[model samples]
Target: MSDTSDRLLGETTNERRASCQVAPGLTFTKIESTLQDGQTRYVRVLSVDFAAFTGKIRATTGKTVKDRERTSDMAGLMASQGLEPLAAVNGGFFDIASEFSPGALGGLTVADGKILNSAANGEAALTLGNHGTNLWIDKVWSQSRITFTPPGGSPSRPDHVVDGLNREPGRIQGCGGGMGPAGENDRNSHPDNLIDARMPQLGIHCLDSDETIVFTEDFGALPFLPGTVRAVLVGADRTVKQVSDTTSGLVAGPGEHVVVATGSHAAWLQTDAVVGSQMSLPAADVRRGASAETAVYFNGTDDAVVNGGPWLVKNGAEGPFDFNSGTTPEHAYLTPMNSRTAAGITTDRKLLLVVVDKKSGPAGPAHGLTMPQLAQAMKNLGATEAVNLDGGGSSTMWVKGALANHPSDGTGEERYVGNAIVVTAK
Candidate 1:
C-alpha cells in the first residue's frame, strides 16, 4: 500500500489491531475492543486507495436466482474471470424467500455499467466510477423503458415503461418504484409483518395485476413455471419474433430480450406487439436525488454501482431518515444492535468496506451495533458519507484469499447473497 501510516486510522493509538496489506492499494484491518457494557466488538475494514490501487472495485450479481453464491465463491468467480480478487463484502438486501422467484434484490444494482436492476424507490446506493476513482452515496431512482412502432405508426409515440429488468413482473420483492395514482408503491402480493415504516409494503412477493418486466439474457431462461403471464420475444434486430403466453422453456437468447407482461399489459403486447413489429430497448434512465444530471451515465460507463440503505452518515454526520421517524417506538428497525456491513467513501475519496461482527460465538464479544452506532463508527473511520449494506447473517468479509470475519450465521457459514462489492486487479 501507499504509506501505511497515512492510510490507516493511526494504529499506534489506543485500539487493539491487526493489519495487513492485501495488494498495492488494498489494506485489511481488524480492530478488537470491549465496549463499556463489557461486550466485545470485532470490526473489519477493507480500505482501498484508488490512487495506488491497480484494479477496480465493482459490484457483481448472479444472472439467475439459483446463481446465488457465497462471498468466497464470488471471489473465486472473479479470479476465474482473470481479475485478481483483493477484497469483497456482501451487497444490498434481497428477497431470500419468494413464491415466484427468489434472489430479487431490494434496490438498484449495476455491474460494470450494466443496470442489473433498477432502484427501489429513492433508496440510497453506493455508486463508484471505473477504477474506483469517482464515488457517490445518495438516494437514487431509475427505470427501464421500451419503444415500439408499428409499420405505419408514428415514431414520436411515447415509450412503454418497464417495471423491472430481469425480475419477476409485479412481484416486487422490496417494494420500490415510484408511487402510483393510488399511492401504491408496489403490488404487495405477499405482505408479511411490517418490517418498519420505510418498508410497510415490503414482502417477498409484492404482486401487481398489470405490469411489464423486461428479461434479458442476463436472467438466463425465463424463471417462471406454468403461469398465465404472457411474453413478447424480440430479437437483437429489434423485430418481434414471437408472442407466447406459455411461461415454460422460454429464454432470452443472445442480444435478445423478452418482454413479460401480466393482465392488461399482456393484452397490449398481444395486439401492438404482433410478430414483425419494431422494438427498441434503451439504456435505463437513472437520476440521483441530489443531482440534475441523468444518472444513466452509470450504465455502460465503466462505473460500478451497488444498492444499500438507509443512509448511516451524510456529509460527516448522521443523515436524514425520511422514511422512518427514528424517535417513534414503531420504527425499531434501526434501533436494534445487529451485525452490520456498510460501504463508505472518505472525504479524500478513499473507499471503505466496514463489517461489524455480532456476538455470534464466544470469541466475538460484540453484540453488533445500532444504526446510529454504525454511522458513528463510519464517521470515526473518516467516512464523510456511508450507507448500510445487507448485514445480519449475510454480513461477510473476504480478503487475502479467504473469509476474514466471523459470519454471524449461528453455524459460522456464510450465506448465499444476491450480490457483492469486490476489489479486483487485472
Candidate 2:
C-alpha cells in the first residue's frame, strides 16, 4: 500500500515501529486503530513477497480428519515432516460436533496437491497453484469421484463408484457434496440445511444405508461404527490388501488407506474387490461454472487450496461476490461485525494474511469489523483480491511458533481449528 494509505490506518510504512520481519521476505505488522467513536480495533497483517521470496507456503491439516488443534500444533506437525515453520494462520470453517468428525474441513481443501475434502456450494476458495506465484481468489467449486476397476478392467469404465473420501459415510458436513442415496438433510434437498443442518432438527446425522467411504492414512484410524460395515485395506500402490466385515477400528499404515462400505456399497467390496485389483480416487472432477481449462488446471497437482467465503475484494474492486441470500442460509452470518481472518493477493502480486481481533470481554474496547468494513480494510491495505477465512474463536495468527494475535475467544486463548496455511523456509 502507498505511504499515504498507511498514514490513514494510523501507521506509516517508513515508521513500522509495530512491524517486524518474520523471515527474509515475510513481514508482520500490528495495527491498533481508534475510530471516531473512540473504539479500539486490533489488526495483524502478514505479507509474503512470493515473487522473490525463498520460502514455501502450504495448507495443512492435522494427522487425522477428526484431529483439531491450535495453529502452533499444526505448524509443529509440519515441523516434524522436515519443514521449518515460520508463520501460520488458521484456515477454513469446519464441523465442531462430535458425530460428524468434529474437525472435518467444511469445504474443498487440497494440501500438497492432495484433495482432503470436497467443495461446498456458494463458497469461495483461495487456490495457490502453478507454483506459489499464481495465487487466485475466486468462487471455485469441485467434485471428487472414486472409481474401482475390477481385475484386468480398464479405468475408462470402472466397475463401481466409491462414495467419498476421508469423511463419515452418511454425514455430509457443511451440507456439501458426498451426499449418498441415504444421506439426508443436505443443501440439495433441505436448502436451509446449508448451515442449519448443524442443528439436530435438520436431520444431518442421518446415515446412508448403502455407502462407501475411503479413508486415507491422513484420517488416522477408521472408527468402529455400528451396523454391518465392511472394509478393504488398500496399499499405496493401489492394490487391495485385505477385505473384512469387522466392527473394529483399523489403523491405516503409512502410505496405506482403507475402504469401508455398508449395505450394497459393501456388497461391491466383498464380491467385486479382488485382492490384487486396483482401487483409486482419480483427480477431483472440477465443476460448477469452472471452465474446462480451469478444471484441468485444478485437477493437476499444484500447491495448496483453502476454502473460505464472502469475497472481501475481487479483481482490484469491491465485491459483486454474492451468494444468493434467498437460497444460501449462511449469507446472514457474513454481514455482522465480528473478529475475522482473511487471505488476499495484492495487485503487485504479494500474499496477504489478515486477522482482526474482537471484543475480549463485556467492557472490552475492540468491537471488530463488519463485512463491508473488512472489505474496505483489505482494499485500503493494498489487496486486489481477498476472501474471508474462518473467524470468531477460530481466528488466530502464529509467528515463530507463538501466538501473534489476540483471539476473540473469551479466554483470549487460541481455539482448536480444522486446518492452517503455513509458511516454511525454502
Candidate 3:
C-alpha cells in the first residue's frame, strides 16, 4: 500500500480502537483536508464506508490534471489493497463523456457570437470569453428527479431550475428526462407554472418551523415570468411535500410577477429562498398591493413535497448559497438526461442536479478536479447517486461575479450555456 493508504488505514484502526466501538455500521477511516492554492479555503478528503460502498470526499476545489491522476492512482491503490472503489469500474474510474463530441465537452452556439460548452468532463480545462461563462461542478441528484439552479446574479432573478421526472407510465419505470418541454413530453407529466419569453425562476427555502420548500415561476417573460407558481415543501423531520399559490390561497394564472414567503432558520429553506424573497418583495409588492402578493403565503402543511411515502431530504441549503462569494459571477448547473433504472450491469441511475459557481483561479490543465477525484468527492459526501456536473470553461459558478472554485482558465471569463439554473421567487 502507498504511504497515504497505510497512514489512512492506521488512522482508521486507531479511531476505531479509541471509539471503543464493536462492528460499527459505517464510519470514516481517514480525513485529509488540504489547501492547494495560496488561498485559505481547502478541500476535504474523507475516507468513508457506508457498509455498502466506500470512498472519499474531495471537498471543493478546481480541476487539475495532477490531482485527477493522483485520484485515479489512489482508486487503484485502494482496490489493490482489498478496498472496493464503489463507483470505479474494474478499479478504473468511469467518466461520462459528452455526446456532442468524442472525448470533448458538449458545445453549443449561443445567440451572441460565442460558443458554449455545457457538457465538459473533469479531464478538460475551461476557457472563458469576454462575455462567455463557465458552468459549476457542485450538484445534488435523486433517482429520476433532479433540480439545479444557476449561481450569482442580480436579486429577484432565478438562478436556474432543471428537473428530470419520469414521463412514461410504467413504460420503463423510473426513466425520463427534465421537467419542462421534455418533461411535458414524458410520462411523469407535471404542469409548468411559468412559460414565456423568459425562463422560469427556481428557488428553495426552509421555514423557521423546519419545513423545506422549492419555488418556481412562470417562463413567459425574459428575466421575469407571469403569475405562474409551483412549490415543493419539506418538513423538519425530512419529510417532503408540495406547496403552491393554489394551496396558499393566492391567485394563480400566467403572467410575470414576483412571489415571496417568510420563515426562520435560514438553512431550513432549501436553496437561496431568502435571497429570492429579498429580490421579489419590492418588485412584487409594487405590482400587486400588499394584499395580492401577500395572499400567496406558505400554508403550514409541509406534506406537498413528498415523493414516495418519505425519504430523507437529499438537497437542502447548507453549502454555498450566495453566488457573490470569492467565486465568479457565473455558475454551471447540471440535470439528468433521464431517470434511473436497474438493467443488468448498467443501472439507469442518472445524476440530475445543478452546480453553479464562479471559476476562481486560472484556467489550464492544472485546474479543477479530475473525473476520479470528483467521484471520490461524491463518495466522501456519502452520495449513493451522483454524476459529473457541467465543467470546463463553461464550468462556472458565480454570485454576482465573485469566483468560487478555481477557474480552469485564469482569464476570469464566463462561457455561454444552452441554459442555466437560477434561484428565484415564486
TM-score of each: 0.87, 0.81, 0.23
Q: Residue 206 CA error for candidate 3 (Å)?
A: 35
* Residue lDDT tens for model 2, 1-426: 112235424422232227789887899988766556666677889998876678788888877766788888999988998889899999987776656467777677888878777655335678876545558876555554565666776544353445456776665544433222122323232334334332221113323456677777777766667777788888889888887786367767888878887776666666656688687676666543323224525545457788777677877786653432111333545566799899989878888999988876333667687676777888888999898888888889999978887787777678998899888875
- Give the per-residue lDDT digits (tens) of candidate 3, residues 93-153: 1112212111111211111111111110111111111211121112111211122221353
lDDT, candidates in the order shown: 0.72, 0.69, 0.22
User: Runs in model 1 with CA error above 4 Å?
Assistant: 1-14, 63-66, 150-158, 179-205, 225-227, 290-294, 299-301, 324-329, 361-365
- Between 1 and 2, whose lDDT is larger? 1
Across residues 98-207, which tens digit of lDDT does each residue of candidate 1 receive? 54455657677777777777666556788987676558887677766677676666444347777777666766655654522122344444445344322322222355
Q: Quote the positional error of residue 193 for candidate 3 in Å.
A: 31
TM-score winner between candidates 1 and 3:
1
List where candidate 2 sits over 4 angstroms from the true fold: 1-17, 129-131, 149-162, 177-188, 191-210, 262-264, 274-277, 287-293, 296-302, 324-330, 361-363
Better of 2 and 3 by TM-score: 2
